[model samples]
Target chain A: MSFDTKENTPGTVPANGHSDTTPEARPLLIAIAGNPNAGKTTLFNALTGLRQKVANYPGVTVERKEGNWKFDPGRPAARLIDLPGLYSLDATSLDERLAREVLTGRLPGLPKPDLIIAVVDATNLERNLYLVTQLIEYNIPVVIALTMVDLAEKRDLKIDVEKLRSMLRIPVVRVRTREKTGLSEITEAVRGVILEEREADAFWIGNAGIDASQQADEIHLSLSDDEAANRQIFARYKFISDVYQASVGTFDTERANFSEKIDKILTHRFFGLLILIAILLLVFQTIFTWAALPMDLLDQGFGALGETARASMPEGILTDLVVDGIIAGVGGVLVFLPQILLLFLFISILEDTGYMARAAFLLDKLMSRVGLHGKAFLPLMSSFACAIPGIMATRTIENKRDRLATILIAPFMSCSARLPVYALMIAAFFAGQTVFGFISVGAVLMLAMYSLGIAVAIAVAFLLKKTILKSPPPPFVMELPPYRIPNLRTVIQNMLTRAWLFLKRAGTVILAISIILWALMYFPRSQAPVADESTAARVQLENSFAGRLGQTIEPVISPLGYDWKIGVAIIASFAAREVLVSTLSIIYNVGEEENEESPTLIGAIRGAHDSGGAKVWTPLTALSLMVFFVLAMQCMSTLAVVRRETNSWGWPIFMFVYMTVIAYAAAFATFQGGKLLGFS
Target chain B: MEKIKVLTLADVAAGTKAKVLRVSGSGPVPKRLMEMGIVPGVWIRVVKSAPFGDPIEVRLRGYSLAMRRNEAESIEVTE
Candidate 1:
């Protein structure tokens, strides 16, 4: 039967020598669906490289990835949407629901796809076809893009493409994205089907004329006890087994495959644990060694840019605001870009190579102890670099409560931004001192602080899962996909897409927050000017809104052994935790120092006095401040990302209040408890 | 007539083969397990357990799937 062009969206011309175009041409919608780790991503990238846009589905954290592709030369392009990987058409998860909505043309702004490409992993034929069985029911022209045929054939499983095509009543194109094979064949098949729909009904499924997805749920709800579903499942498999047995030849008792051989060593109980730790160490080292130089260069580049703007521009509020507020805000955003890109590079590589699942498998038990999924391991590990990327990485986790709990406790990993704060506090007081007569006290304290963050994170995750964010332990049915050498092109493409999303979604919020923070510290310009510039800065900070607010909270912080000046520093650090050092420098009237390693900043901290000529600096106070930074939610960019990820302000607000209270109580305990132990 | 032994999938050791008799749970766990193609009369082989020993891997329908022992208990099998 010929396809009806009238029912399709008007004005979208099919360029296959048959044009019924009117006015403007809107692209036809095509969709690609498959199971996770089935090489669906590779095929989609191969078809639509660099032409894709990744965005979150409206008001949901699930990503909606779409790209434009022309089926053949001189043909009109179609918008190809890569749906989330799913096991079935049933709407048990949000991803599945979204896929159904789009499939049924029920989702707003997205029409039903004019064509469907089922990316089937040839090695896993039976289960993959289970989805294909449901796809043909939609009455859309369906084509199979069979992937990994080479791997399947290597296992002595021979597949006849023509027989498969005939049995399934659809076109089957064996495509290997790496070799660039079968791309045009698949395209031609698609073009042919789009022009002329499949006339013969799929005889295997008795009622193939009706859409099963729409009825499957209704039937499932009404039938109630699994009989209908089991029957349907068996019927589909019965049909599948016939096609499989006819079109494929299997050599039984084949020797262990390459994946099994590799897993023999990689997943060994003792060796697997050691290798995992080694890989983690490698990741840790890469962050410190490779990302360090780029981070430093970005830091210096932004600092120099800010200085040049201040030097060349005229003295006014606009100059200060642009240089201090806007430029610095943008700097804070891009400074983390290197870390985010690096984190995703590793994550994408691990995930593509399929080792991430093994990592998850190995660590699943330890993570579950804290009420988290095994996949939460990487996100929490990468949070030590920065929570922005870590929070974004939680997309791998499917359970809502587990994902939120992971996001909430990620910042407690003591990110790199907290390093400068720790450096200054340690150098000023604990420098050159030895704990237990041999170990450097500063080093011990640093390790203790990191340990403290880890301890607090585990506790928080446990508490959250037991309390409000509680849910049943998600069923652990994971497929160990065959490992492949990571494709650099795909890894980099995914990395860049994630990095761009971070800039657009989280960057703008950080810019706005920085301006407000600047205004808080910049407003009510003291009409009276002082002779000394440094003294003028100190005086101005004391009168600014932030200064007064910090003073108002001085009594609350006093129990934590902090004065109003320290309170102001704490407030300034909200935008960026590293700003604590620079804020202390300005308040102490030291030079404009940003680096915590600067000797003058530490020296100033060592010999500062309050209004009563009492020593404002004490060793116990430094320890308390370090404890506070370990738990406090100080970074605004993290909160911005949290708000976006949770799709609500409520979670972020709750996160902030809980973290601050915990920080306060911990700091109070440290200061008050240390006094009892006579450690001052 | 001799009594036949009924064993859960978890009792199947690594490298052992078994035929799935039935999936016996009514919770979402069994529903999901079935949705992923673990049904009655399928021949499945126990692959291996993870380093932690709770979630064990099984090869069925030519692909390896990992699930916890608790969920695996729902699948009644006979060697």
Candidate 2:
């Protein structure tokens, strides 16, 4: 019945906790709360290290991260809950609301914390204090985990922790979570607060309970009726001032403030946007260059593994299963993990360093000018990497119109899932021509497709605003946090966590799908016997369930310049996008044979032709296929995520159907247009 | 003096207010405009749209933000 048992810990238990052999004692619950990018996550990771579990909030899509950590040396089996980052207790977005809900015990089955650890960004005190003020009202024992003290000192900001602690009536400790310094002090402070069982200060409730109308009365108890109310309402600020005087110390303020000066340019109407675009372009280029080597290694490694397995086993169903089903299907999805991880790495860094909010600040005007809310930019930007997260990110946007519009246009921004499809086609059709020195024809084609997606998104957004999903624009309220040095540990931890999730999925959903596809193309227990098993195996696949399905669909796709084999590949690829490559590998009898020196995917596609003496994968089919993927929502996982995020099956189904229609129409137009031009 | 139809976010300056008259696109323009807080009844102020008209900057709800210009023309505003 206990969620707080030692079993809640994910990894190894601490050495101190291992010595405890008696019956259970009440474990102290520590809740970490902070403003976004306040190093709350860093401190959580530092405290818990690898002992954590990531789950989804019951009905909502917000990530639930929990871990176990020892507070006191005497009692090392205490529990730790890493709460979501929040700006204020008056929550607006789902993330902030979830944080508040968990803290307030509104979330079902989530326990109330015995002690609260308020992670405050030292460099940004005034803004972060808003949340601290609210948490004090909850009457919980609080220990202020002051973070980014190093940056605060460099910026000429001074903090009198002792004075502030007296004013707020809470234990306060300054720690640099990323540097692994002051951790013991933080733990000691947490232990002190928990063990002491400190009661909330009366002034905290007195200050926090005031409203705008009664502000004056709280401060001046004897003031006249209206003035008395005013004092009551303004009492909160008075309390804050008292706390500021007590706990905080002053330092020399004459030092250079790089953040403000930088923000002046970065948040500027003209210069800021140019920098953002330039950064985006650089990111796109980096994704290609940095990911290429790893991608190639993965492709070769999977091929070699399949080949080795085939060689070790005798020609039988087991060999086919290992080579084609497991290797082909699972490997197809696994190959893209590196590229996805790299993309996530950059996003995590950008977000952690406080540049993400600036990017939004720079894009607000442009979004508003287009009739979209500023909050939509985050999701749209994420869409460039992957639509699933982008769609999930729509929760951050408060306005219904803005959220819907973002969700609708997100898939239009070419995601990493579509990268494999585009890469395959561009390599096959436009091999080695360069538009400029750095930009090749293939790159140009890719850029053009991306450009087209954006253009179409804009047009679609405008049209949709006028016709459907029409609502007045909500006021754009966004918090702009000051920049701080990003914690390297936190960024790496984030990257590793995401990569682990991807690897986990590859073992389950992707593995199952891959095996099913393998069977479809591998079986009906082929009866044909021959001396040479390899040649007979190729003929047996042609008689399999997948082959029959492909043959049935061939007549429809014939004019699209695809053969029965291509048709089969397309069908099998629906489980995932990159499966197209593996499906082609299996269909072309390259499943068990690993030869990098032989014909590559592009070469095979180019050499393929139909009985009519026309090349099957002509430039037209390649173009059509690229356009199809650009417009179509082919990734079922993305749809599932969308449904989970939106909390509605309607949107996912609509997304699937509408996008598929768009894909078909676009591909049809491309093919017929090419035929009329006599290119094919 | 004549009241000009509110030009695109490109034509506006930081800290200036304009009334949204009509969004410029069929469904796409208005849909995007609505999403960005530029609906017909809402008055918008250009905070700092980006340079080269890429991500346009605007202020709403007492905050400043920037977005793409292509995203902006969809909103027809009146100053």
Candidate 3:
């Protein structure tokens, strides 16, 4: 069968040598389909073994991951598509639509799957079978891989595989994916179906060729249940029952899902909230603790590299660009990679363990009070890592208004990139001040920034609820999957995949942006060098493009106590938040040096002064800077993601403008207000 | 009838039936409620309320529905 090139729009390109056309000549198209949390992903990962492409579905935002695997011992290989985890063929969510589209050959560029590998959670058979029975109607070659058998067995449930096979007339393979027990058999069964099967008459393929438009219509029409709709549903259920009994086996057991037990305690009203708070606190603490060593190492390593470059090269513009501009600007941001990865690692753990949903359950009531949904909580929580993924995660929120609101407020959460800037300022300006000798100034400043973020998010959400994109609250209908102990293998794999994505972006987007900034600050040399290293660097920078640009814009930001240096840092940081610290470092000429002798960016800021000998970074200025960073749209990646997520530049542009204005105003207030209160 | 505020199904006593009067919020509320088979004509009965009145289990349209207390508030009901 020839694959329609236009149909596969989600950016999934097959890794195999076969051309886009004529997929039939290459390998069998096998789709692994099942209910969410049914071990489908595990089975796909095991079968494919690393040959996979993660992409999006065309015309929709659902993630599509496809791979190739040799299921049978003698079979060459089968192209496997791991469709989204869907509860039913009746697509409600965007992800479900893509899964259904791929299965039905409606999704462009993707060949209609030749065979269906239905991965069922053996423990939740009856519920999972609802979809499997629907797939059998498609008359495609089908193999049932029973997963989570270990959990089923523990719950005292036993499935008669032979009986089920006879009932369905399809090959049945039982496998425990996490334990890696039934992989070989699953592959063998798939091989048997592909190699040993007769060419099924495509024309006579049961009800499998049901009209797609009609199905979509039916799904749309079944939105409500009056007595009539209720009867219609019962009729559908009857049809399901006939197919279900004909194709599935019987299992009886008191399966007490561990997740349910944990939910009872953990999702308990009081305990659930407490646990959530404690978890967030722990994550915050761990992010600081775990990232410190690697951060220091990266800091020192970059500093040394810069020093080496400076020592080796003759003092010229090229040398200045390499040591002062590039290393200073980019190295500053790169040091935070450890913290970002750790933050994602924690998020991945929660997601894999399925506690994230529970956290949503606990927080939904509190969040909904402010017009946010429970589903929005995960994405908002993820913003603490980075707003780009957090904004992308809004796809989980099905309602358009809810998703938009969530995206709008996500950046307001204190992301890790903002942490370095906060830390530098707090350490520099608020070193030893104590509130009644109980709370340190650093601690208070940190609390204030975090609190400001939350407050701003709430206010914006409230305004959005009342004004733009106004809507009644979306119905909250999230499935609480039976809790399973997170498979460490899967968690680690997912974390690596996500971290790799971040690093890739860092190497590409951040790298390009850093180079451009370096070039901008290296050109248009000053007439002559000044006495001190810092003064010489500053004068030369002011003559450069970035420096000149900053000078032009300095007047607008002067009220907030910022000079051209801070203005340039703000502009550079717009590419990514962590760049703020590094841009400032570069502007201060904190190039490569020995770790012990090299001054930290924090130290440089403490000692900085303008031409008049007045301190450049005072307590008031530091506080104003922190407030600006807290409210500003400093991450271009996040803006780009918002564009993709919203499918418009309008919202992202609006977000950027509104946030910058807020940041500028807040900083102005803090600085001028602090001065009025005699803090300066 | 006092048009008893549609408390979360958890807050309602077991076996008590109530009519959905109106949903409190705007936008996507209808789609959400409709997805749950909670159309205006349907009468729902509280089957069980979890501790702390959250994710209260209710029976309607021949299926068991569990909703958080906040979700329940969106569905204005009359006893």
Candidate 4:
């Protein structure tokens, strides 16, 4: 019946702070609360570093992060929930409301936290403590974990801890996350107050709810809801400013701080853009260069694994199911691991170092001009690696409309999954052709596709904001946190966690559908006899269930300059876009087994002819197919993730329908118009 | 003191310091401004604008905050 006792992760504190009293009362629920960039996450990570689980709150997209706080060795670790960072509890946004609900036990299924670790920054005490004042009003025991003390000290500022403790009537523990000190004080304080019932001196703020209204009457002042809120706001500030003045001392030095100086150039109107472009280019280059080797290794490794399974196991239905269906499917899902990890690695580093906020700040104007939140920038960029993680990243945008807007347009970013399709198309048709002597035709084609995706995404985002998901422009109030050297441990841990989540969620669905597609293409065993395995394989693919489905849909897709074979590959690619390459390879007998980038695939596709002996893959047809892949919602994994993120089937289905219609229309134009212009 | 010309935060050029007169208009912007400590009498300084000249960064309460021009335009201030 315990969720805390079983998980004693390594590197936990040996907590012998106080003697055990409660045997096992369902693990004390402790909540960690603070402002954004106040080192709340650092403290939470310090307490519960590697032992954490991330899940969604019941119906909302707000992430619920929980970990174990092993404060005392004598007692089981307490459950530490990291409440969403907010400025105050005066809930204006849904995120704020959800946070308040969880804090006050108003949220069903989640008990009110037994104690709160109010992480107040030593540097930004005023804004941070404003939340603390609101927190202590709930009558829960509050322990102030003063973070960023080193930074505060470096700035020649000293915080009077004793005075602050007395003024707030709570335990103020000065903890340095960098030095790993003062965490024991936090445990001892929690134990003294919660377990030993050591109440503090009377607090400054009155108890929660209706206090200001009662205080209004105490001074014979009538109040509206707005005025009452204003009084409460001013009262909190009045007390916070008093706490700030009495508890903080500063030097008379007047020099520009290190962070401010860096911000000057990073936010410069001209140089900032150049630097941003340079950083983005470097990140994109690194993603491609670093991920290529691992991706190729995975591809070959899976091929060898399939070959081994075929050789070892008897050539029966189960072997085909295992080697052709399951192994290939699993490998396809796992192949995305490298790019996802690298993307998340860079993202976490930017987020942990606090440069993400600066990036968001720099991009906010352009984003807003298109009616998107600045937070949408990171997620949209992440879509290029894969849209599943990109969709997950959209949770940071608190506004529902904006987040949905970002999600709907994210798939237009030409994800890495579609790269094989584009490469195959370009290599088959546009190879060895160039505009001038400089840029390769293949390179130009790739750039045009990427540019097309970006352009379409921007247009779709603007339209979404102006229509279905419309609202008054979303509020873009973001904090540019002081930059820090990213902690390698935290960054790696975050990257792994995100990559793992992608695998766990998207990976499962992909495996299932991959098996289903395998079945559809495999069933009704072809009894056709041929001169060789290649001929038998090609005949089997032509008579397979998926092949029949492709022939049936020929009328619908033929106008796009696609034949029945292309139809089969396109249909198979609905489960995952990358499968188009392997699917085409199988149907064409270019290889006995599916190898996505087999150099022969290009030649096979280019030399292919229809039933009447006319060329099947003209440059125009290849271009049209690439256009369809660019605009189509071909990946079931993205739809599954969209369902989870939007928490509804409607949005995903709407996304699928609109994208398919657009993709079909655009490809139709490319083919019909090309023939009309005598290109084909 | 000589009469100081009034301006919304949007009108205050970068590198200028101004004390908030009051947060005007209704809806979530002003409410959020209050939570961020943009209430009356607290002096705030505009640090800079973003690359394309928006989302101005302001310093107050020992931290930096960035808000769009629309949000900033609502915060009436006096230099």
Q: TM-score for each prediction?
A: 0.92, 0.78, 0.83, 0.93
Better of 1 and 4 by lDDT: 4
DockQ of each: 0.62, 0.09, 0.16, 0.62
Off by over 4 Å in 4: A1-24, A92-95, A199-213, A216-221, A249-255, A592-596, B1-5
lDDT string for model 4 (A1-680, tens) is 00121111111211221123342656778889888778777788888978888877898756788998888888889999988888887755566778777776668887666778889888778888888887765555689999988888888778889999888888899998878899888888988876675532323352123433344455344554454555566667777888788888552223457878997788788887788888888988999999999998998899999999999999898999998888998788788789889999999988888888888998888898889999999999999999999998887787889999999999999999988888878777777887888789999999899998898888989998888999888889988888889888778877987887888888789889988999998887898668998777788888999999999999999999999999999999998898888889888887745454567877788788887999999999999999999999998999999998888999999999999998999999999999999999
* Candidate number that wins on DockQ, 2 or 3: 3
lDDT of 3 by residue, A1-680 (tens): 10122122222323221335554466778899997788888988888888888766776656677887866655567788988787666545677767777876767887777788899877666556656655665556678899877767676656677877765567789897877788888777767666655332221111133443353345446643233223322333444344444544332322234655566677666777788899998997998899989999998888899889999999887887777667765676678778877877888788877778777767776677778887898888878877766776787776788889999999999988888788777777787899988889888889999999999999999898889978776566655666667877678776766666556545566666667777777777677958887677667776889888898999999999999899988887787776666667667777423222234766788888999999888988989998999999887767766777788999999999999898888999999999999988
Docking class for model 2 is incorrect
Grade the docking of candidate 1.
Answer: medium
Worst 10 residues of 3 chain A by lDDT: A1-10
Per residue, candidate 1 scores C-alpha lDDT tens digits across B1-79 of 9876899999999998898888885755676777677877788888889887878878888877888888889899998
Colliding residue pairs in candidate 4: A15-A73
**How much is the lDDT of residue A670 in candidate 4?**
94
Taking all chains together, the TM-score of candidate 1 against the true structure is 0.92
Alpha-carbon error at A65 in model 3, in Å?
A: 2.6
Better of 1 and 4 by TM-score: 4
lDDT of 2 by residue, A238-324 (tens): 455455545554422223356545777886666776788888888877887888789779977888998899999999778878887
Better of 1 and 2 by TM-score: 1
- Report the Cα lDDT for residue A123, model 3: 66
Tell me which of candidates 3 and 4 scores higher on DockQ: 4
lDDT of 3 at A323: 74
Q: Per-prediction interface RMSD?
A: 2.0, 11.6, 6.2, 2.4
Candidate 3 off by > 4 Å:
A1-24, A53-62, A198-233, A239-257, A304-330, A529-534, A585-615, B1-79
